[model samples]
Target: MTTQSAGEPGEQGGPLGMQIDHVPSEPGGSGTPGPPGPWQPNLVSTPAQKKAAAQAIEDHIEPDTSKAGDHADDETGKAVTAFAPKDGDGWVTSTSLKSAHKTWGDQVKNLMNRLASEKAALRSTGLLFQTTDFGIGTGLRQTSPLDGY
Candidate 1:
């Protein structure tokens, strides 16, 4: 009683249905050959490109702090600041309002820092698309809950 492998002809219920003529042991195979060399994309950023991207991000965030200050000056903004309690000598002291003000200020600072860090990291390593080019190609169609109308 002898057994035949699937690669052999006349083996009906074997792993491989058809017989494999030959198998190459080389890395690629005995064919046209692999790529001439390693392939690279043309979109990779250079040092200058990375620097420019970082600079652009910095420039964009530069006005954000001032904007935050302006927003804090509004009535609602002042209300947040005024939430802080004043001491007997009229010096603003630790209180819920002071904490709220600190929290808001920290949030704005964190946002700026995060944006700058993300920009730097992304610039160092090129991204599929720049931050600004995200929504360029899109249809103008708008949908809402009242779609039937």
Candidate 2:
């Protein structure tokens, strides 16, 4: 339930820009483990529909290849990992971009609402939810043929 403050919406005082770790638990390990109790955020039940919806949502994330796709770079001999800021050792966002907090919240909420709707659609498929799988393998990158990665 941690969220940005109603007022000031963007700053260190508020929790707006903070990235919360969302660990999607298994679909149904509770009780008898036969049927899914409910459609949890991270838990994609056995039916491929639920998993497919989750996959689509994940693919929409426009990953910063320099920060993400590092695995690919390692094999290709490219250093994609960001180096620590010479100014300090720990994480620190540029002060000029402080207002980004509010924007980030808006983006996350919009994506979440879309994902929720997709999950609901899967639930209506009339199949028992047996297992959950949060698959984020199929990544989508908008790369131009001119800009070789």
Candidate 3:
């Protein structure tokens, strides 16, 4: 089933359905100010939230996605190997398939490595921000008190 936000006038929602709106007159230039009001931030992530996201990726998403890719890679290898010519006569198709399989396996490995890197970055984010905050607070505390004029 397709899903869309209300009042979007036939706009759909999903990765492929993403739409860009309100292009500025000049590229990358501030054109017009938005309607003045109390603006809420679109993104707000706490240290705990970052940590939890990292945990979820490591514990669930990474494993599930990698498992599917790995299974596909293995199955493809087995199938291609089975179809390969024994006498090495008509080996064109088999060779092509083997090459494609290797390419796909490399892609999957790269994706898994990227996910692992992302997970590591997420795990360290909380500590990095905490240290930054502490340093800022300490610097502020070191300031001399103002005297009455």
Clash pairs, model 3 backbone: none
Give lDDT per model, in order: 0.61, 0.48, 0.76
> What TM value does model 1 have?
0.34
Q: Rank the candidates by TM-score, best first.
A: 3, 1, 2
Clashes of 1: 0
Q: List where candidate 2 sits over 4 angstroms from the true fold.
A: 1-96, 126-149
Candidate 3 lDDT, 45-141, residue by residue in tens:
8778878888998899889988988888788878777778887555676788888888887888888898889989988987888899999999887
The 10-residue segment with the lowest total lDDT in model 1: 32-41
Per-candidate TM-score against the hidden true structure: 0.34, 0.24, 0.61
Task: Please provide, for model 2 over 5-93, each residue's C-alpha lDDT reduced to its tens digit, 9 standing for 90 to 100.
Answer: 45655655653644576544655454343544556454435667666765565565323322333443353232212332455662344
Clashing pairs in 2: 44-132, 46-131
Off by over 4 Å in 1: 1-53, 69-94, 126-149
* RMSD to true structure for each model, in Å: 23.5, 25.6, 13.4
How many pairs of residues collide in each model?
0, 2, 0
Candidate 3: list runs displaced more than 4 Å.
1-41, 137-149
Q: What does candidate 1's lDDT look like per residue over 57-133, in tens digits?
A: 77866576658655874644566545544564332433555566667778778887887787768674645454335
